[model samples]
Target: MEEIIDQNEHVGIVADDLTSAADGAGAFLTYGYQPLVRRQRQASVGAPVVAVDTGSRLMEEADAMRATGQAIASLAGCRHLYKTIDSTLRGHIRAEIAAAFKASGRPRLVIAPAFPTAGRTTVDGIQLLHGVPVAQTAYGHDPVHPARASLIADLIAPDLGRMATVPVSATDSDIGKHIAGASIIVVDAHSQILLNRRIAEITKHGPALWVGSPGMAEALAAVVGQSPDRQTFTPPNAPRHILVLVGSANHLSHAQYEALAATGASVADRAEGIAKTASVACIHAPRARTADPSKVLCALVDEADIALSRQWYDAIVATGGETMSALMERLSIHTFTLVKELEPGFPLGCARLSNGRPILLAMKAGGFGSVMTLCNATNAILQMGRKST
Candidate 1:
């Protein structure tokens, strides 16, 4: 058994991917917690909130479980542990959740995967995106780790032991009734207010593993209280040049790319040999579907690597979790100090390279954000550069 520390001031969040890690941590920013997103299972002592990216969403079930367990074990000192799952029910949810439950030594696991801000809500144990079942959404056709079921219970059945579903309308007493004698409780939340109430009730019940999206994280931050004093770190100088890498084949990402290009940003199908004529340059994967997602990811990474070798950019905007993870690995970037959110669920952080050079990094999920999101991010980067100068 791992030695558990009893300190409620610190929080540990384990996410299955890089973007989700940042997204999960970003919520704490409101409470004056300086969150750090680490790519590995290393300890970052003294950080108010630490989010570790297990990078196991696309891995084999056993591999995902092992990775999640190791990550949770490394965060033994944190009294509060949160597992961030995709709102649409992507990834190896069962394996990772079970690993977190076992590794954290928590008696029960409370799951509430709702992000009303992003139009994700849970009702009667079923997950809905923009009021439609997630199975009928674009996420269902994800190139990798597509959601097979919209019902949260059906998605993680048989492996997580006995489970119960608590509706959003459940009062404090009602919530207590559902949590009793249940190893896992899935709470339904359709709005932020209800989500916060559910989290408060569930947490009041006892110390159990909390699992959900960023909305849950925000609620956790509120329940945990604010830090004594806000810790401030100066961000790196804004980049005069920005590189936008689109590795997701999602239609929303494609629309964002097109919108950015329409703003006069240079666009290219490949990252290599693109001239630095514009302040912002975008390299995106072919719009056509590819049978092998791994190959497309590898090629995108290689192209981005080659482009970086040829020219230096002040900031990098990566749109997909896999793309961001691959790029960070190529650049040997394992740690990111989150500055703030460029947009909800879109985080801007300062990452240090192997050579100790700090660069600005902004990450967004492929399926997230509106068509103007990339354009707005690019403009934000430019505005930051002007302010710094």
Candidate 2:
């Protein structure tokens, strides 16, 4: 596909969580857009592409809608708008999407929540995770916001109006026919090629609100074209101390934490011991299935805050959105300047505390990374620090 350059086009991305917001913005980094992820809806935007985390997924349905609507409303002037949803169909998908649609005032809403790289796909309007219906996957049993169904149409609220489903094999004209009268259209995309084709065809229909995960962000970035001046990354000075915080209850996250622990990283028994005993220390929530998520997150944040008070770490790695969000809030950090993505869903960036101290941060969604992801991230952080010195 040929690149379409539009110097005046600015993109706005709205996500239900922080990790999603960072990864969504990180998608535009390849095209030379310096992306910024703001924790608040009204934060200043210094980059062409800005992603905002509404922190709405943890809210009740009504509050989620209000938060989502306010965030979209704040981004009213952006020429292009995208909403990021969980690829596995978790959270208040229906309510938040409805709010974004109402706020954007875009004539058509196109929904394609496929991330082929992660084995999430949509086929015949059914959302699948690794060839199994999402409702049958681990997400269905999520401690919070479990998915109730795999059918895309079934997941969306009926009040949103009739939705047309476009198959992967559908021609451009077939997509056009579906877009003409449908208020919402769900496209079936099982691969990168199919997803790209669907996005390319949809963009031709003029301005419409696009919805999906990071895969959709990548496609939109392509449509927006490469920037005239690509930004170069300058690795920050190596961190002398590193902290890994794991607050996700996902089995995958637990496994990743275990893998990192096996590498001999000290597991912190007390906040006071973190700064004195080890250069690399890990703090994780209990792995019991019956652990209360809210209490667990609060404990992690309290422990991290105490560690920071004793000594500020140069680099911190956090798993799960709730964990990262809670930590950032505790530090009074409202914005994250995305430098690069260490991996597809793992974004590395810098954030300033209320006292104006900058710290390197690497964040990942609980369910997204491999078992070795945390270990690899730690190694990468150490290497970056070493190269700079």
Best by TM-score: 2
Q: Over 4 Å off in model 2, which ranges? A: 1-9, 158-162, 273-277
**In terms of TM-score, how similar is model 2 to the real structure?**
0.92
* Superposed model 1: Cα runs more than 4 Å off: 1-9, 41-46, 136-138, 155-162, 271-273
| Each model's backbone clash number | 0, 1
Q: Candidate 1 lDDT, tens digit per residue, 1-389?
A: 33333355378898999988998899988777778888764444457788889889877999999989987877755868899999988899877887888888888888989999889999999999999999889889976679878988775657667899898667878887887888889989889988988888788787888899988898898888878878764557657888899998888999999998888888898765467667898899988778988899899888888778878888999998789889988898888888878888888888888888889999998888889999999898888888777
| Superposed Cα deviation of residue 70, candidate 1 (Å) | 1.2
Candidate 2 local lDDT, 1-389, one digit each (tens): 11122334488888999988998888888888778788754445556888889899888999999988887776756788899998989889888888999888788888999999889999999999999999999889977789887998876677776788898778877877876788889989999778888898788887878899878988888888887778866655567788889887778988887887788787753576554556678888877755467877888899888887777689889998789888988887888788887888788888787777789888998777788998888888887778778
Candidate 2, position 89, lDDT? 91
Best by lDDT: 1
Weakest 10 consecutive residues, lDDT, candidate 2?
A: 1-10
Look at candidate 2 and tell me the lDDT of residue 361.
Answer: 86
Our tally of clashes for model 1 stands at 0
